[model samples]
Target: MFCRILRRPGVLLNQASARSLNRAIFTRSYPFLHGGPSIDKKTAQKITVNWLYHDGKTRPVSAYVGQTLLQVAHAHKIELEGACEGVCACSTCHTIFTDPVYDSLPYPSEDEEDMLDLAYGLEPTSRLGCQVTLTEEMDGVEVRIPQATRNFYVDGHVPQPH
Candidate 1:
């Protein structure tokens, strides 16, 4: 099972390198004022997201405030098992917030709470990764994906043993 998951192409393309490229492009295109409080132009705030996978790999990704955690993971091509494509239906997107700062995010909706109940490895800090959006206050947030979700499931299609 682990081999099958790891076999996915381009799964481990150094996420930090990609993020740096993105940051460089962003900073060059839009340089914000270095000085304090009298802002005429919009300033971009950086939020650090640590995506922890079942294989003990922790990927740190940088995102702007107001971006969803799901969006950030997708951009970095991190192998988060989003079986429902972030639609809040499947528990495959379940994750636990390793960083306490995740508490700063707005409370999850009823649907999110319901879906989380179906997730494996439920814990006090468990949440649906897709449902968590990044806010300025949630800078430096860290989340972990449960091992159970690493495999993809296709209806009536069983994956062969590697």
Candidate 2:
């Protein structure tokens, strides 16, 4: 097995290098933010979103009408992870939509359902961010990033060992 020491403390040496490689590949492949429906700034409209971050911070952001939640998050540099690049291939972008907004959104596709099944904090209101496109109706919606999705290295919350 490949192994080495890392200058940083608290991170497992093995995981440090592996995580670095994965993050490189992951960030490089996050194409959802760039390529999407064209938006005209002058014509573009915005919606207010109350973002409940994983570390328990609530923030308000303006989002575009034609972009997915994941795209909005990435645009604002929100910490949500979309490992599958908004293709619905993974549940890394799992999020919760509060109240009437959750009911207003369309039903999840089979692919999204399957992915959400693997999510850490699955709830009735849970939906993958990649699958939920923002719309004018979603204005003032509350979107939450589950704490269950915290990354030990980044979020500073380590998971209990199984």
TM-scores of the models, in the order given: 0.60, 0.70
Q: Which stretches of candidate 2 lie over 4 Å from their true place?
A: 1-34, 150-162
* Residue-wise C-alpha lDDT for candidate 2, range 77-97, written one tens digit per residue: 777787666666567788997
Which number leads on lDDT?
Answer: 2
Candidate number achieving the greatest TM-score relative to the actual structure: 2
lDDT of 2: 0.72
lDDT of each: 0.61, 0.72
> What alpha-carbon RMSD in Å does predicted model 2 have with respect to the real structure?
9.6
Supply the TM-score for candidate 2.
0.70
Model 2, position 11, has a per-residue lDDT of 55
Put down candidate 1 lDDT per residue, 1-162, tens digits, no spaces.
Answer: 343444458666244333333433343322123221132225767778888777888888887776556556766776565655555655666778754654665688766766666677888788876677667777666777777763457674432211
